[model samples]
Target: MLEKNHILTPEKWVKLHADYLYNYTISRINNHEISKDLVQETFFAALNAMKNFEGKASERTWLIAILKRKIIDYYRKINSIKGKAEVRMNFYDDGEHAGEWIEERVPSSWVSEVEKDIENRELGNALEKCISALPEKYEIVFRMKTIEELETEEICKELDISSSNLWVIIHRARLQLRKCMEDNWFKK
Candidate 1:
């Protein structure tokens, strides 16, 4: 347990990276078992690749960077199997799977009843409607940045807008969405 420049064993490494792998995979797949397996695979892959690791970043960060690519690869494999339709679940359909992934709901005895009541489809739907109703240009920018997970530079290029325009539209879109959520969704 005490040594200079101790090398981490595989078992020790797995213990360290398990939580991160699980979370990152779940963020992509929303399926726990699959995510767990992917994480296991990621650890082994990282272990094999450790020879090339120059410690440019900490070990945990390196594993996580690997895990992100593995998650992306998982999506690619799932897309190949299921086609693009399943990959692109319509925002209007049942969002139970969507609801399960975000960790917004957790087993808790401590939350107030009022707080519990505020989190539901009524809010999700209202937010969706508000997003749907925005001007097309603004909506495209907001959805690409927030939902589709595009980077700002990519979004600007795709929308043919300046960085400043992107910022303005995103800020306005968020404000409008927030107002809609407050007005139509919040159970006040």
Candidate 2:
């Protein structure tokens, strides 16, 4: 059902949609060069598939759909079993409070204050460091599940693991993060 009402203007895409598309891709991919490549790939794919456009959605929406597939494809390529190697464990250094959160009480909410802002920034940095310290597969699984907010089923499919296996990985990843936070973030 290709309606004549919606026509894609490929020539105007760069001027009109480039920034929006780049922002979308960067937010998900987080690498400047890779995001640019993905955006260009999206445009090329859209151009090649222009004939298949059904005109049910706006041009921007259609472009985003193609971009989403490109992102998923990128993840699938990186997480493929052929290239995967045995991951080494880099758990946080052993200490008395191993695998524990040392906070007396969790703050109910962050107030707008300079001290709070500094603390929040430090906490975020510590957490980011701990995440990167995780083993390769654990880091990838944790990021996809928590940061990207992808559905469990989608993550499992992309990682080519069973649902149960995905959960176990997530659980172990959380434990690793907790231990790291205890050593670095909570201690400070």
Candidate 3:
């Protein structure tokens, strides 16, 4: 008993939805390889669970849903307890607040973990928009040092910049990130 409005068409998945899925993955993951892997994984998972499809959603929408879960799982795997470095260290050493992301400095005493997951999604989108709005260099360095949690020396050497220059760039990037988060996320 399936709905006539929607049907599972697994054979056409690649041609019909590959590009759309890849584009979505790349924008969120920021790593081409990981995004590709997630897209492929989504296809596999959907195939295995195809029997469970109720035809409630179009193939594309259902695929995107699976892809979103895959993306979330990827991030969770990278940010696990063993990946403590993934957490951005606080740059400031003040009397009050010692360390955390520049995004956290915006005073979000309102957002509790007990809140709805939808709120978190909106916040993530806003943060992502702010991050993408950053200047190219800023965005790259910020992701490398903050999001990717690469070592200071590693990032500096890879980017072919002096340690001091890297720090300057990171500081400026954090400042801009804070401002952007405040304006875009907090205001919402």
The most accurate candidate by TM-score is 2
Models sorted by lDDT, best on top: 2, 3, 1
Which regions of candidate 2 fall more than 4 Å away from where they truly are?
Answer: 1-4, 81-119, 133-141, 148-162
- Model 1 residue-pair collision total: 0
lDDT of 1 by residue, 1-188 (tens): 74334344567776777887686555445457887887888888987887877655777777877876775565445425532222221233355565242332232233245477656767667777988766544665677788778789975654456899889778767766765555565535
Winner by lDDT? 2
Cα deviation at 159, candidate 1, in Å, is 20
Candidate 2: minimum summed lDDT over ten consecutive residues — where? 105-114
Q: Per-residue lDDT tens digits of candidate 3, residues 1-188?
A: 85477888889999999999998776546778888888999999999999989987889999998987786566545534363323234456555545644455544543454345446777788777877776555566678787778798976655556789878767867777776776665544
What is candidate 2's lDDT per residue for 1-188, written digit by digit as tens? 75556779999999988889998766555668988998999999999999999888899999988887887787667656543443323433359756454453232343345355456776788878988786656666788889989899887765566888778778768767766766665544
lDDT of each: 0.63, 0.74, 0.72
Clashes of each: 0, 0, 2
Better of 1 and 2 by lDDT: 2
